[model samples]
Target: MSNNTSNACINDSTNQINIIFVGMYSFISIVGLILNLIALVVFCNNGRTRSHTVVYMTHLAFADLLLILTLPMRIYYHLGFTGLHQWMCNILGLVLKANMYSSIFFLMFICFDRCLAVNFPMSAPVQKWRKKAWLVCIGIWLLTFGASVPIYLSKPSNQTQDKCFDSIPVFAIQPIVVLPTLFVGFGLPLVLMLICSWFLVRAVRRSTVAQTNLVDSSKISKMITTSLLVFLVSFLPYHATLLLLSLNRHNITCPMLDAHRYSLMVACVNTVLDPVAYYFTTDTFKKKVDMGAFRRMLPLNSQSSDLTRRGRVAEDS
Candidate 1:
């Protein structure tokens, strides 16, 4: 892939855009961070979280929290608030990449765990699977760390007032490096998550028929399905654009740069969008939110479910 000299040449316009991105990230990161943290606290305080799903929710919160922790550096980096230094770039890139990949892997884990629980509910209690599940989560983090370390180890670039530059050799952007990241970070994980969610939905539907006390599991299924779909819908476009850009770098023109920037912005949106996905997918989070604790922690107001129910009933009638 070839880099466009004009695009690579960062100008006042580029700086303005980056600043705007930082602003957006700041708002998103703070909101998502606070919500996930509240979820974590509620999980700890409530005794209702002994289920396997709640355990997964805890780890999911940790992954998201780790990602949120790194957002300030990213915001600063894009804002040009930080000194453009090699170590800073390396460290920031490493932490961000690690957390991102870890989150992706954990999404896969949650989907798979759900699938397993639904498919094998009669064999053994899910709590017995908890220890092994944690081990698997740790293993996923280590594996993702291994795959993502190169992003940090790669040479750093400096963004000056006059221009944006990478000290790393241009050849470093070769398909070899780019392809692996696209696969590990986007492609493979996307495929695995989709497969797992599919199986999970099917398993849940099948198992629900055998369980007598369970209400219709459609709500839970919808939550998982929507979460995974959001991940796909939000991230897939960006990855597709990146892959196209990677493959046709030599011919990319100035007009395309605008689209590329937008795509990058979309990819960055994941930093904010993920918490919404987490809140929807995890039951413990919904319960806490329903109990008004979530609104109490934030400055938001909670409307009563009774009013909502009345509205729903009127609509249905």
Candidate 2:
């Protein structure tokens, strides 16, 4: 009787969590798809606007779109449709990881772009970097695609076909691969973003023109804060759980697996958060995609006016 009761409780919790996951992914994928489509339309229509920030953000949006495509399959699986083909799993897994890594790379470059423009407004190399950013984004795509190849080659030995995206085989998740991905892919980018944000703040404070350009300065601060919050909130727990996966690669537990899945949901939440970055960081996004338009899509509208108002207040001060 006791064992039966325990099993029933575990199952009840699982069912509730599954419902949440399904609903969460459904909402995120839908809104993310629409927002990213709008972003691309705006960027494409932004003729003659060759801003470095736009270049990085454009790629970031593209990456997000690709990543969002995989969410439906996840929702399908969560709905008890687990008999998916291995090839389909391989392809979705590859695309999902490739874009996930690419999104983070573009995010890192976006931070660096802002920091460079503010801190080195005169260097010839920096001036030339606008053109170079395109090449860098292309390279980011190639690198992430290459890095994620293992997912295509290695199949999940433990779980059935329905268990596609939830876990990976321990052998496939080699320590070398996992460690580097955790440190270099996530850790290094996080560190660089922090350092760049610090430099950006200092440069803004010391700017000879800052007294007159308070609005731009506030915009910079808001952009940095929004980007960092997105990164830390979405990516941090996922990577931390990823490391834990490595430590207990051999003796995995059900709770640990659940934690890993939940962390990944958090990361996917980045797709929605990316638009917030767009609103705060890019002038084109701010002016072209009005707060009212963005709000009609979601509650991000509530934040838009507050940010704009605060910037105006700073300017008035």
TM-score of 2: 0.84
Candidate 1 residue runs with Cα over 4 Å from true position: 1-8, 12-19, 46-48, 77-82, 125-130, 156-173, 204-211, 251-261, 280-283, 290-317
Candidate maximizing TM-score:
2
Q: What C-alpha lDDT, on a 0 to 100 scale, does residue 184 get in candidate 2?
A: 79
Question: How would you encode candidate 1's per-residue C-alpha lDDT over 242-269 as one tens digit per residue?
Answer: 6666666676555455555555556555
Summarize candidate 2's per-residue lDDT along 28-132 as a digit string, tens digits. 899999888888766765535446777888889999999999999888877666568767777887887788889999989888887777766667887697558
TM-score per candidate, chains pooled? 0.75, 0.84
Instruction: Output the TM-score of candidate 1.
Output: 0.75
Candidate 2 lDDT at 301 equals 38
Candidate 2 ranges beyond 4 A from true positions:
1-17, 156-159, 169-172, 209-215, 291-317
